[model samples]
Target chain A: MVKLKSNDDKEFEVEEAAVIQSEMIKNMIEDGCATSVIPLPNIDSKTLIKVIEYLNKHINMGKAAETGEEDDLKEFDEQFVNMGWEELFDVIMAANYLNIHELMELCCQSAADRLKNKSVRAVREMLKITNDLTEEEEQEIINDAPWAFEGPEIDDTVN
Target chain B: MEYGLIFLLINNQKLEIPQIILKSHPLQSKIVPKLTYNSNSCKTSSNTSVDKKVEEKSFATAEVATLMAPQIPSNESLPKLPQELITAILVRLPVKSLLQFKSVSKEWFALISSSVNGLIFYRIWFNSLVLWNPSTGKYKQLPDLMPTQMVTTGYCFNYGFGYDEVHNDYKIVALFREIRKHCVGAKIYSLKSDSWRILDDAQGEMLYDGSGKLVNGKLHWVTIVDGGWSIMSIDMVDEKCRKVEQPCYGVDQFSLTLGSVGK
Candidate 1:
């Protein structure tokens, strides 16, 4: 078992097979450097638990094709990324910090999919970004490509 | 835990690895510089209680979590996402959404503009070609082809645009057929010099007037050569026309069109 202590000082025990899915931890183990508990200063306990769940679920990924569990894995991934943007952001940061390539890709794609058809105003509100463009600049952007803003699929509501 | 130890022993072939690297490895030295021997003595009292309170709520829906995440006390308030993470998200967005996001902020405008890597080529009218980069908001209209009148009314007005990495230039290749004279003419436009030159060696009776498919630094077109439909390609570097070997399809279908998928 590999012990991982999150920034919140809460420690969780993960199987070596599951925890090695993280490239950083894998490298540490391979280098014979993971003798003691691994401290993940950038990851909180909640995000660490989420990442551990993903790692444990994905431990048999290599055997999934032979065992006919691809659908189960796919469904798990879909449910995994269905969390809120803030939670997704935390997961993304943890994934990045842990150097988990697949987790990073999945979370980033989810983030993009949510923001895909959002209107400028919706995106600004979601990110809490104040629009710095002047009226003329905004007009110029709309004038440059009027069709972009006229699409029926553009959503104004923030999730 | 016994299985994990056995797996590690079998993989590494060294059971003494733990003792040899203990307390001296980079994971201990670099990551946790203030490494303390007493794990039970570290900062855990207040944080564990706070985590328990948050955990009792269970997982909420995305909308509810978005409303609630900010309210939960963070040990370290969420930092602004790094630029690379933002760029990764922005690149996945479709072109239309990206354009709409230009008004979000000056930082966003610059990021979105820089994220756009390719140009858009379209014909507004007969023989009038415009190359536009929506990111940079720069566009150039090609000068009228020398045989604009003849090519405009021609039966075949096939064209293709692609970047030439060799010369670091953007080029447009067009094949025009004069129905009246039964003549096929080809022209190549160079964005670097802002000029067009006649491709005198381009030879083929085009099967259709559709645009050529750009692939592997070449513009490919379907043409009729000696009563058989063949694939012809123009090398963007040498500006020479060549025939590509066609796949062995049952020699019955005549309608052959050229198209490419992926980058």
Candidate 2:
């Protein structure tokens, strides 16, 4: 077993085989190995837990036959990420920190799900980003530089 | 309880990608300094939060060319905009940017690919649809589009999109190419009718690739014509493909130019 400690003094234990999903852990195991504990100084308890779940699920993807439970678990993931904005954000961050590729794609797809059909003002508001453009800058974006805002994927008729 | 590894996005701010968090991500041991999400944001937004409205405009394509992305931290902060607002912003970007933004965060990418929101964004894509009402003196971005015909045929996507607010409806014109070896045609789709609309006027030509502009609800493009492959255009609203009439006083016919005409 491998034990990962987060910054907030939370400890998570995972099977040694599953822990190797992490490239860092994989290398450590291959290089004549790890012993007592793995220190994940940047991750919190909650985020670390999420990472473990992803690794476990990923490590089991190929065992779907005898397990007969991989698809169902994936459904759980679909529902799991369907949380509110703040929770989803944290999950995304955690997935990135842990280098969980599948979880990152899944979470990103989830976040993208929430942001369809909004205005520039709404996008600024939702993403917590300021316009940061001077009046000229703003005008230039909304005005002179109409080319920049043109989305080739979007039609002109609806707006 | 088990959970995913987290990358914290302080305050839901775009520029709030804390340095400590980056150094601690799961891949940090492998790719710390090489990642440029924060540095890229610095180049774009100068580490300012989207909370207080800044008075600056965004960087132009020429100034802010996109680069290949580094590793992603799944826990990065998300934009606080509602689903619709985010879709609006996505609609304004080129498909390439939308594709890139999908990697920045999971939420954004999902919305871009969602059936409804993706549909809306697909409707008003390419360049901004600047429909000058002249009457209201105000304009708003249109919603994205859906590929009605592509979904119906269960075929892969071959489509185009635009808004027709003038007709009191959002318009989407999707194209589906024929599979026959000797013959070819395009099928169109519209959001207003929520059904597949077919078009036989493609001239078996593809001018949709050019930088076309929509003015007064008509689409125009600078493309090659039939005789010599010169500048050509097609009105999405009317489906009338026409060649641009260039100046004819001994000017070079090969030198065709197309630009936006403001009303």
Candidate 3:
């Protein structure tokens, strides 16, 4: 078993096979630094819990296809990332910190999907990002490439 | 009481507590609920510090975040992403979406317009053409140059699209036979000027058999003139038409087609 300690002092016990899915943890185990609880000063308890759940679920990823559980695993992954933007960002950070490749890809893809096909205003609202450009500056940008702004195929509203 | 005391001792000592004592603590369930609340408060306080560290780390190096933890943005209400993460998301978006969202901010506009993202062209319905940039999701439709009367005349048209390096423009060349007059006419459309100009010098008693092939700022077509096969090429730079002589004398005209060998 591997014990992971989150930033807020919460400890989680997970199987060695499952925890080894994290490249960072695997490296520590190889270096003999994993003898004690692995301290993750960057990840909080909530995000750590989410990361551990993902690691445990995807432990035997290679055997999933042979066992006919590929569709089930895909469904689980699809449902796993159905989180708010903030939570998704947290998961992305946690996954990056833990060096969990699959989780990082899943969260990043989810972030991209949410921003896809959204209008400028819609994207701004979704990300809660303020428009830092002045009206004239924005107009000049549109004028510089008028055809990019004139397409009828783009949606003006958020999806 | 023992578990609570041990937690206080660990906090004071800043030392790692053994996993066995944590798991064996009888009041672990009660302690977890209180810890959850404490962690929530701790998150709020540490978020800003963590964000600052992430910003410093990201700015200090241009390296990929391998083992180092990426800086999470501190603004909890708004999930403001770093420039690198935003680029990661932008590259995955379809070209159309990238174009529409270009007006979101100056950074996005610069990223989409930058030359790192190459342009792609797609032909729609054989009559109109759309040029798309996959990185920006932006597309521009070229103006239709084909006349309405030509569509119903049943005349076969051959088209050649190429870039003119000398003029720094894209040109679409169309050759169509005037069935009534038994003559062929060539028309060139310049994307820069957004207009088509007829090449009056190209009128000839020749038949264009297949599509034009573009090579080295020129368009080549197989033509049958006076029952003899010859290759006709148009130089996009000077807008001049010239015929390339057959490599061999008296080779059967039926077996010849215009093709490029190598660069």
Complex DockQ per candidate:
0.21, 0.06, 0.20
Interface RMSD of 2: 11.2
CA shift of B177, model 2, Å: 46
Once model 3 is optimally superposed onto the true structure by TM-score, how far is the C-alpha of residue B245 displaced, in angstroms?
65
lDDT of 3: 0.56
How big is the positional error of residue B52 in model 1, measured in Å on the Cα after superposition? Answer: 33
Q: Who is ahead in TM-score, 2 or 3?
A: 3
Candidate 1 similarity to native, TM-score: 0.49
Q: What is the C-alpha lDDT of each candidate?
A: 0.59, 0.41, 0.56
Residues B183-228, candidate 1: write the lDDT tens digits.
Answer: 5678898888888888877744533324566678888876655445
Tens digits of per-residue lDDT, candidate 2, A20-136, equal 766445544554445767666546787678778777776777787577886787787887786676566666655544444457556765655454333444454555543333454
Clashes of each: 0, 106, 3
Across B155-251, the per-residue lDDT of candidate 2 in tens digits comes to 2122334445455444444332221111224444444565444566654543212223444555554332332324444465666656656444342
Where model 1 places Cα greater than 4 Å from the true spot, the runs are B1-79, B115-263
Q: What is the lDDT for A18 in model 3?
A: 98
* Pairs in clash, predicted candidate 1: none
Quote the positional error of residue A133 for candidate 2 in Å. Answer: 1.4
